[model samples]
Target: MSGTLALASAIAEMDRDALESLVRRRRPQAPAGVLDPIGLAAELLRPDSILRALSPLDRDALAVLLGLAEEPRAGLARDTDTRTAERVSALLALGLLGVEDARPVALPEVTNALRHALMTAGHRPDDLSTPPPSRSGDNASAPPAAPPSADSWVTAALTAVGQTAECLRVLRDRPARLNRSGSVAVASVRGMAESIGIEADHAAQALAAADRAGLVASGGSSLVVSERAEEWTESDHIARWLDLAATTLATIPAPLRAGLVREEPLAAIAAGLPERFPLLSEAESTAARRFVVAAEYLGLSSHGRLSSVAELLHSGERAAAERLVRDLLPPAAPGVYVQPDLSVIVPGPLAPADEIDLAALTVPEHIGVASTRRVTEASIAEAFSRGITPHQARAAFARVSLTGIPQPLDYLIGSLAERVGNIQVSEHHGDDGRTRIVVGSSELADTLTVDRALQHLQLHRVDPTTLCSRLRADHVLAALADARYHASSPRARASAKAATESTAPPRAQDAHDDLPEALSDLVERVFLAARSEPGTSNFTRRLELAIRDRVPVRVTAEARGQQHTFLLLPVSLSGGRLRATDQAAGVERTLPVNLITAVESA
Candidate 1:
C-alpha cells in the first residue's frame, strides 16, 4: 500500500478518544472543525509539516524513523521492548509512524523529508564512521550512581556567578567590539580574562554563560552589559545560578542533547552519538564543548558526571531544583575577618550586601578556594573619589567585620576625608576648550604633571594656581582618582556615554515550538472542504501529488448536477483552487477544490 493510504487506514481504526489524544499531543491549535481520520492523515503527510515535526524529536525516535523508511512495512518489529514501544507510540501520535499489518512503520513522506533536511544541514549519514562506544556503559540494568557532594557543586556555582559578574564589570567599563560575525574576538576574551584574573578558558565559558543569561548583549558592533544585569546582580545567589544554568541548557540544540540521561556525563553522551546520526559542524562541536564547560561551572555536573540539580532541571522540576540548590548552598558568613595588615579574609561566602559593598571598597587579592581582598590607602582614596564618604566607608566595614575596624584602616579613611576635596577640577571654556585644574599647591601640581600614572591627562601647567587639560573635566577627574589623588569636580560629573545605543536585553529563544500549529489552519480548510463534498480531502491530496510530481491525472468534477471527467496535466494547487491543463481541450482549467469529486492517476 502507498504511504498515504497506509497511514489513512491506521488512523481510521482509532476511536474518537484516541484520535483526539493524538491530535492534542501534536499541540496544534484546535481546528475550526473536527478532522476525520483521512483528513488528519493527509495533513500530517504534508512535506513542510513533517519536516518541522521531525527536527525536534529525540535521537532514538529519529533513528527508528530512518530505519523504517528504507523498509516501510518490515523495518520495525512488532515485538518491541517497553522503551522501544513507547517511542513507537510517540511517533505514531505525531503521525510520523503508522501501524501496518499489526507492526509500526515509518511514514514515507516524513522519512523522505527528514532525509532532505539532513542533507541540507550537511549531515551525510551514509559516510559517517561507526560511533565509538561510551566508556560508561548505556545498558538499562546498570545501577544508578551516587551524586557528587553538594558542597563542591555549590562552591563551583558561586565561583561561576562571581567570575561572570567580574567579566560584566570589565565589559561595562570598556565594551569589547565584535568581529564581522558578531562574535567576541579571541584577543578581547583573553583581555577580559586577564582583567578578571582567571584562566582564559574559564573566562570564555563565563562570557558564554553571561551572553546566554542575557546579562551581556550585542550592541551593534560591540558587547555591552545589558540593563537586565542590574536586576540579576540584585537577585540572590541561588536565583542568579538558576538563571545561568537554565538559559545555557535551553540554548543547546535538541540534537546535541538527545539520548542524554540523568547521571550520564555530557562528554559520554557527546562521544556515544551514533556515527549515522547527524554530524555536528566544527562550530557546533565547539559550542557542545562550551556547554559542557558551562554545565560544570553552573554546578550542573562534577568531574563530568551529571549532578542531582542537573537532573531536576532537565526534567523541568524547577521548584524542586531551586529548593535543592537552596539547601545545598553553603551558609553565608555573618562577618569577615578584618586584619591589621589591611586584608579581609572571607572565611565563607559573605552576605550579598556585604560582598557587594566590600568589592567596591577594596581590591580583590585572591579568589576561588580562599577569597581575600586588600584595603590600601590608595584603595580608600579611590573609594572616596567615587562619592563614598569616610563615614559610609567606616560603617560598611564595621557592619561586616568580626574584628572591629583596625587603627590603620580607620586612619586611612580619616586622612582621605581631610584631603579628598583639596584637588578640584572644573569645566573651562577659555582659550581652547580646556578643563581647569587646581591643586593644593604648586608642588602638588608639578608632582601631578610629571606623575607617570596621570601622564595620559596631559596636564599643561598654566601658573602656580592652575593647570589645564585638553580632555573633558570628567576625564581628568577620573584619571586623578585612579592615581589615588582624591579629586572632585565642582560641576556635576558628566554621565558616561555607552559605546552603542542601549537596547532591551535579548530574550532566550528556547521555547518549544507549537509543532501542530503549522498544520492547524491547513487541516481546518481541508476539513471544511471535505465536509461539503465527500472524498474532497483524498482528491486534494491526489491533485497535490500530481502537481508536485508533474504527472497527468484523471479528474472527475460536478457542475450544475452533471458529472464530467477530464485528463489534466496538473499545473498548480493554491488558495483552495487547482489549476490544470485539460489535455483533450488543450486549454487551462482552474477548478475550485470543492467542485472536484475525485482525482486519480492517468
Candidate 2:
C-alpha cells in the first residue's frame, strides 16, 4: 500500500465539494510539502529523488491510505479487517501517512513529493504550487568545487524569471495568492499564461512552486511578493529582456527592419530580444541610431520624403539618389527636399539652385487638391412667398456663371433638379482649369446632401469628386430623393406648390398638369399636405397615401446627361393598369393599388 493510493481512496469516498472544502480548510499559510500534491509527485519521480528509494505500492495499499486520510476519525478500528490494516500499515511505512497521537494525518513531505511527481507527469495539481527555481546560488563568487556549465547560470536566471520577462512581471504583480492545496485555478492562471505562450495548468504549477519559494505570497484577493522574499527579486530582469529584444531585432531581415522598429523607441526595441542578448552593456547612442534607422526603414518616421527615398533605394539609382540628397538636405521642416537612398537634403531656403537637378527626382503617381463651391436651394413655398419664379432662379444661377457641370457635383445637382422642373447645373472653369459645379435648388436639401457626403469622405482622405467617381451617381441621387421625399409632409408639399405657382409663369401651370399622376402623387405625398376637407383634396391625399404605403417607388429613369432619375415602380407592373394621358410621358402605367408594397414620399 502506498500513501498516494491511500489518499486517493480517502478523497474518492467524499463528495467532490466536501473533498475540496476539506483541502481548502487544511491549506497552510506558507508553502508546505502537503500544500501541493501534484508538485510533490513530480519531485518524487525525478531520477535521483528520495521517492525512488521506495518500491511501488499495490492499488489495495493506495485505496487503504485514501480511506484513512479522508475519514474524519482517522484510525482503523480494532475490529477492522486484516486486509485493510495491512494496506494501511504499508502506506505508513512509505511515509505517505503518519499516525499523530493515534490519528492518521497526511505527511507534508509526502504530499509535496506527490505534487511534484504529478506535475512532472503532466497531471494537474490539486493545488497551485510554484516549483522552486531549477537552480539557486548565493551571492558569493567562489567557484563551485565542481565547476558549473557556462549555460547553467543563464538557465537558472531564465527559470527564476520564468519563460519570459513578461511572465515574470505578471507573476511579480499577481493580485491574488493562489491556494495550491487544491486543483489549480485554470482561469486565474490562464489570464497570465496566455501572454507568455505557456499552457495555463503548466503556468499555475510553476506559479505554485514560486509561491512555495516565498517569491510570491497570497494576499486573499491578489498575489504579491512576500516581504521576506523581496531580496530574491533583485536580478535585472528588464535588462535581460532588453538584450533578448535586441537580438531579435538583429535577426530580422534588413528590408523588414524599418517597419519593425518604426514608432518604437530604442528602449522599447531592446525589450523584445531573446534571453541570451547582451543588453546591459550596449551604448545608448548606438542603440538610438539603430532604432532610428529601423524606424525610418519601417516607415515609422519621416526620414525625408519617405516615398522618394524608398523609390530611389528600390530603383538603385545612385546618381539620382545623390541629387535628391542635395535637394532634400537637413530633412527639416519648411524645406523643399527630395528623398534619395541614404541621404535627405534641401538645396536652399525656398528654391533649389540650377545645379540641383530636379529632373532626377521621380514624381509620385497621384496628387490631391482641396476645393469648395457654394450651392443654393430655395424652397418653392418660400420662393413663391417672395414672388420668385423657377425661371428667375434659373436666370440667377446663369448670371453667376455657375452653369457648367463638375463630375463630382453631378449627383448633388441632379438630385435637386429632379424635384423642381427648373433647377440648373453650372460649372465655372477657373484659370487653373479646375471646374466648380454649382447647383440651384431649395437651400435646405442642397446643404444637407453636400454636408453629409463631405463628412462621409473625410475619414477616407479623398476629395468629394474622387469619392463620387467610385460610386454610381444614379444610385446616390435615388437614395437622396427617396430620403427627401419621405421626410417631407403632405401639407409641406402643397404649400411648396402653391408658393411656386404664385410666382411661376402661366406655362409653369401647364408643366405641372403634364407631370405623371404617379410622379405627382409621389410629390404630393412627399411635399404636400392632405386637406382635412372632403372632395378633391381628400381623394388626392388618400390616393397618395395608398401608393406611398404599397409600391416600392424609386427614381429609375434618369434625364439625359443627368445623374438624377425620375420616380417609378421598382419592378414593372403586370396585370391591371391605369393610364394618365395628360402627363409629360403621355402614359402612366398603373399598378394594382393593392400590390404596392412600399412608398417613399421622398
TM-score of each: 0.73, 0.17
Q: Which window of 10 residues has the lowest lDDT sum in candidate 1?
A: 492-501
lDDT of 2 at 554: 39
TM-score of model number 1: 0.73
TM-score of model 2 (CA atoms): 0.17
Query: All candidates' lDDT scores?
Result: 0.71, 0.34
Mind giving the per-residue lDDT tens digits that candidate 1 earns over 252-280? 65555765676766766666543324534
Per-residue lDDT of 1-602 in model 2, one digit per residue for the tens?
23332232333233433333333323222223322222222233233443442213322343343345445354366217787666565454333564433445554455555445545644444222222222233223654233222222232223323333234345443443345653335676788766445566446544543443344444444454445333433433322222332222333332223223323333333343211111112343245345444323232223311234323433446466445434433221233222222122322221121111111111111111111112324333223223344455344323322223333233433453444333221222433222222233435334444555433322121233222222333333344354343122233345433432232111112211344443333323312121122212211222332233343233322234434323443333113332212133544544443333333333
Count of backbone collisions within predicted model 2: 90
Highest lDDT scorer: 1
Pairs in clash, predicted candidate 1? none
User: Where does the lowest 10-residue lDDT sum fall in candidate 2?
Assistant: 362-371
Candidate 2 lDDT score relative to the true structure:
0.34
